[model samples]
Target: MQEPQSGPDRRMFLRATAATGAALTLGGLSTQSASAVAPGGFPDYTYVRTLLTPSQLKYNPTGEIIFPTVRGVYDKLASPLGRYYLYYAPHDAPGGICLAYGNSLEGPFTEYPANPIVSNKWDSHYSVSHVSSPHVLWKEDVKEFWLYFHGENTTTRLARSKDGIHFTYDKVVLNTSMMPAGTTETSYARVFRHDLPERGASYVMLFMTNNTTDHRDIGWGWSADARTWTFAQTPLVRHSDVGAINVGGPHLLTRNGSAYVVYNKDKTSGGDIMITEVGKDFSLRKHLGVFYDSRSSAPENGRAAAPSFGTDGGVPYMIYEAGERLKGAIAVARG
Candidate 1:
């Protein structure tokens, strides 16, 4: 991957051609007419403060090798049972998905004794060299948990777990062949379940795809059963539109009858989290501006990426990867 340019062009771009025609101008910089704040009184990106540090989760007692050394925790999910499930890739090469559990967002998490819950060995459709970036969702309709992840940054696979811990390989949900022509890889998938008045109730997915030039962009997909997906050929959130070399790690949060697409911008070494409202049709609306800038102060610290949203007692919060990839840690920010 090439280094991201550090110019004014590196900022999030707001296109005047959106459906709502709502413009967002931050301090007279952007040309949009709307404010950068999200609906339902969601705080601006500058207000995000870290609640947990990587060191707090580094110690694992289960004797299962966790994300050893500098490898950081990648993504996290807050279960309805009041327990937090963290997903990470071991620091070593060919790293697979590992799990840790804890009672509090800030806590001494316990690595699962049976670590690497989903590994490359579990799927044969893709290379068994690496499998990481796991995004797990609970399906209330089926009463089962679904795990969507990628391997070698090439393909995405899905698995199902009755108890959210033990998982069984279901199928390959996304592959290069499923993408547009000349697409080389697909990864970093985030799934959202919503009942839009226009589209009805369905499972929506936002995934990253890298073209032949290695530029990654976000794309949209939909599924009726969460097993089979129909992906769009055109990019939903492209790098050209975002003004970043790469745009990925998509996570969604719905508020006040509107859906928001939160994703990472630029390379992992110097990226920031950005948000944009999504219309009923899953189209990008107003660009909400930076959610977490890596250069910001403590709690809002580091190169934040792979952001996952949750709520604690009705208060919104975010869990993301902070600092450099291998040397980074998982950090939380409360809204």
Candidate 2:
């Protein structure tokens, strides 16, 4: 069955118009676009420093990590969890959900004592070869933290926590079963809160799905609550759309009233971030081209993937994996 599609909303366009109000000045250069997009339209970010490498972590059992999901601890009661929590894991066998903490966005973070808070083996609940690509969302209405991760590269699972450290495993939220026929893998998901009231979904998720042909594309779903989800019959963005061998690491960037999907594409030259503007209906509307290129950066070593955006002291920053796949460092960049 097909999902209902939303018509062009005048308010959405109006909001989009408002989003183009001002361009941001990045690195002594004006990189803003006239189009309605996030201010500065994905900044001309300057590489800052390597925030964390597997070797830096005191308790990196896997000796590798990727997909950094950083969130601020707002509630005063969560003082023990530090001001900020950075969640990441290895996309290898026995993958886990691990965390680090710090007071500042540009972190000198310390790994949690009880690292790998959630492991591949959960006994009666579920067990898989590896669990990686962690995306955590703080549910304000419920006053709880919800973590979404994938294991076996086929199933995306959910686990909730009151403390953001100790988690209670929830059921698998998405897998190949919910996708179109001939689909092989469904993983690398990121969720966001959007203003699409017409869709009847307060939250939306963007994920990477691989087909029988091994082509990777972006898949999407919607939910009123953060738990249950209903995905589109097809991908939201395709490798062919961007002329890439594969595309993953989906991130939702909403500014003013406009929404954009920023993801990494595997190009012959190297991996780089790309952006596409999506309508309020959650449909891919336009390809905005390369958001961040990594070929010139020596630290990135011709590759950058899985970007997580944040702002520190009003300056926009990105936390992403820099270097080759499975052999990279968690890097921080500011603009």
Candidate 3:
């Protein structure tokens, strides 16, 4: 990933992409499919649904177990595994993304061993692998795997995995903080791809960014190869909504022409999960409020860490983490 830059610079990339006619488009939000989840629509899947929570993971079994600083498993890419594949920062090192496997929809999962496919700064001084949550990318043309995630030194890195178990290559794609020393929100990035599947060859690099200076708002990046990122010229979303502050965790999910962003809002004042419809090009649509909050008072089980678009019980669902200790488990929301 490229080094992080100013918010204006980032947003410019997005605007330029739109001008270049290389942006995304969406139809709109739909309850038509998510509604069929339950019998009478009694909130069949409001929040408590999960494919694989942390309680099921053993160790970093496969892929990248990358996560954000939000608490539990963070952003995950589209992987169609029966269970949810969470990415997290383990052992208090910088961060890392890993994958776990489950047998059932709601797991008691068993993760791939050898935790930490990528380690914090690779056990070095500057720290190159202090990796964060990763969203996977599957490129049919290259027949290779792309793992996009955040880094502590204030940058997002990318890695290539051939078998999904062992990685082959890696690099940073976001901005490097030019601040005095530290005092930056750190570099964060996520991954998302459109389903249109143009015959040509292309990829989308979704990012997790912050203005850091005046705390402008969460920013983004646009990349075609996942290595050289052009900070989005315009923000895909804002830092707050309806007079609130804080916005992040850009989980872009597309289904049947509509793209949904499962992100966090008001995190400072008791965070809650919210969903919004966005055009393929990142235009805001229906603001679906509160995708899922704490299921119960139970010690605050966890919070919305990362989110990914998925299918639970044949219904489209967005899976996220709920526990801070990974024991609470990951949560899912349909419709």
Quote the RMSD, in angstroms, for model 2. Answer: 9.0
For candidate 1, give the lDDT of residue 290.
71
TM-scores of the models, in the order given: 0.75, 0.86, 0.66
Instruction: Write one digit per residue (lDDT tens) for candidate 3, span 1-335.
Output: 23123222333443454456553332443222311122112232445455444334565333222233221122232443423444444423445566664543344445557766766555332365355666666655566667766656466667786545567556666654522232355344566555323322134555445555434234555555556655545556666553437666666656456666666664443455566776565555566655545443432343554565555466555565555433444555554
Writing each residue's lDDT as its tens digit, candidate 1 over 54-75 gives 3544433221222211111122
Which stretch of 10 consecutive residues in model 2 shows the poorest summed lDDT? 1-10
Clashes of each: 7, 0, 51
RMSD of each: 8.7, 9.0, 12.8
Clash pairs (backbone) in predicted model 2: none
Candidate 2 lDDT by residue in tens digits, 86-134 = 8999878887888988877787878888878888889798878888899
lDDT values for all models: 0.64, 0.80, 0.50
Ranking by TM-score: 2, 1, 3
Residue 159, candidate 3: how far off, in angstroms? Answer: 0.7
lDDT at residue 257 of model 2 (Cα atoms): 64
Question: Which is the winner by lDDT between candidate 1 and candidate 3?
Answer: 1
